[model samples]
Target: MTTVIEVQNLTKRYKDKRALDNVSLSLEEGAIYGLLGRNGAGKTTLMSILTAQNFASSGEVRVFGEQPYENARVLDRVCFVRESQKYPDDAYPRHAFKAASLFFRNWDQGLADQLIEQFQLPMKQTIKKLSRGQLSAVGVIIGLASRADLTFFDEPYLGLDAVARQIFYDRLLEDYAEHPRTIILSSHLIDEVANLIEKVIVIDNGRILLDDDTDAVRDRAVTVVGDAEKVDAWASGREVLHRESLGRVASITVLGGVSADERAEITASGLDLAPVSLQQLIVRLTQKAESATKVIAVKEGVR
Candidate 1:
């Protein structure tokens, strides 16, 4: 696999807030990545810097083994379709496609036409007059059809309904299977794209929390359900990400993989084990990080 993107100690600051803090990661040429994080967790900021739409405050970033800022060679191979993508008020969908055709060397008009028709986008209407869902369809179409070596889809399902979103996901996976390229998907709908992405990069508080294969991430944690007393006893010395209790029943999610023996022991102890979904794991991880930060802040304040 070829390294297409490399970042070393990348940091971005705005005013007093640090959007990206010493982030370092590398991406290979042919894999779909899910850039998962909460709102304001630096997902957009990082993407902006990678695509040359924004500058990093400090540290180095290399796309295609070269700087992306003001570098047309690197920029031409990258497609960034963000929720807040802007266009001329008078520009129609066709104009956007025409411009994209000129920019992306691998632009596929056939795919773009299929998407537009499936999305039922109004070609004659000005971009500004299109509804939110229609506007999102335009971005989705462009992102999928551009066939850029590296494409970023930042919340591309903005106003799309469940069915429409499914279409986007289906087409994305189908296209990716045929055309192997690096794709970075930034979305809040984790479970929806969990199966699509090969790798997962989780960002929280401007820091890289988890960057690993999707299958490995799935095995990071497991949940146990049983009587409150038994559940607590089992989770006593373990890292518990989350816990819920209802009457005499309790459910506890803990960090660490369960071995075959451990699974047998858990079941024999009258506890049922449940698999944690990617969305659930991420939510717990972010909450845990936030709590730790609060504790650290309190400790500093005491000093």
Candidate 2:
């Protein structure tokens, strides 16, 4: 796998707020990545810096082995589909498509036409006149049809219904299989895109909290359900993220994976293992980090 993007000690600040802080990560070619977090997390800031749409206050960002800012060779290979993407007041859907075709060397007109029909887009209607969902469809169409080596879709499904979102996912997967490229999807819909992305990158409060393979990240935590006493004993000495007990039954979410031997031991001990959801794990992790920070601040105040 070739490295397509590299960020080292990247940080961005706006007055008193930090949008991205000491973040560094690498992305390889031909893989789907999920950029996930809460609304104010640094997902968008990170993406914007990588695509050269925004500047970082400190550190370095490289796409395709070169700085992306004002670099046409690098910019031409990248496509960023933002929910708030701007268009001329008089420009129609057709005009947007035409502009994209002119910019992207690998643009597929057939794919764009098919997506227009599937999304039921109005080519003649001005962009400002289209509904929110229709406008989202226009961006989705362009993102998929552009076929850029690196594409970023930042909440590109805004206002799209479940069925419409499903269409976007289906077409994206099909096309990706035929022509593999690096894709970074920044979405709040975690579970919906979980099965589609191979890796996950999470940010919280302007810092990177987690970055790992989707499956490996899932295995980082597990829940054990059974007798309270037995579950408590097994959970002892392990980092516990969450725990709940109802009568004699207890469900404990812990911060580690169970090995095969441990699995057999768990079954022998009359405990049941259940998988943790990505959304749940990430929420707990971020909450835990925030709690730790608060504790440190309180201790410093005492000093």
Candidate 3:
């Protein structure tokens, strides 16, 4: 596999707030990456920097083994679909597609036309007059039909209903299968894209929390559910990511993989182990990271 994008000690600061703090990661070609994070977690900042839409305060970034800033070679191969993309006031959906076709060498007009018809996007309406969902559809069409070597979709499903979102997901997977390329998707709906992405990159408070294959990430935590007392005893001294209790029953999610022997022990003890979904795991991990950050801040203040 070829390394398509590389970042080393990348930092983006706005005044006193650091949007990205010493973030370093690499993305391989022909893989879909889910960039997961909460609001204000710097997911957008990181993507903007990678696409060269925003400048980094310090450190290095390379796309296609070349700097992306003002480099036509890198820019031509990249496509970024922002959450709120701007277009000319008088331009319509067709005009947007036309511009994209001109810019991207691999642009497939057939696919674009098909998407437009499927999305029912009115070609006569000015971009600003279209509904939010329709506007989002335009971006999705461009992102998919452009067929750029590298593409970034930042919350591409906004304002889209469940059915429309599913359509977008299905089309994305279908297109990706036919044409494999590097794609970075930043979305708040974690479970929705869980099956679509090959890898997961989690960011929390401007820092990288987890970066690994989706399968490996799913194994990073396990939940135990049973009697409160029994579960507590079994989970004692373990790294608990989350815990919920109801009456005499308690469910505890703990970090780390369970061995076969451990699974047997858990079963013998009458405790049932449950698999944590990608969304659940990410939520727990980010919450835990937030709590740890608060603790460290308090400790430093005491010092």
On lDDT, the stronger of 1 and 2 is 1
Q: What residue pairs are clashing in model 1?
A: none
Report the lDDT tens digits of candidate 1 across residue range 1-303: 899999999999999999999999999999999999998999999999999999999999999999999999999999999989999988999999999999999999999999998999999899999999999999999999999999999999999999899999999999999998999999878999999999999999899999999999999999999999999999999999999999999999999999999999999999999999999999999999999999999999999
Model 2 segments more than 4 A misplaced:
none
Q: What is the lDDT of candidate 2?
A: 0.93
The C-alpha lDDT values of all candidates are: 0.96, 0.93, 0.95
Give me the candidate number with maximum lDDT: 1
After the best TM-score superposition of candidate 1, give how far the Cα of residue 202 lies from its true spot, in angstroms.
0.6
Candidate 2's TM-score? 0.96
lDDT of 3 by residue, 168-264 (tens): 9999999999999999999989999999999999998899999999999999999999999999999999999999999999999999999999999
Candidate 3 residue runs with Cα over 4 Å from true position: none
| Per-candidate TM-score against the hidden true structure | 0.99, 0.96, 0.98
Cα distance off (Å), candidate 2, residue 262:
1.5
Better of 2 and 3 by lDDT: 3
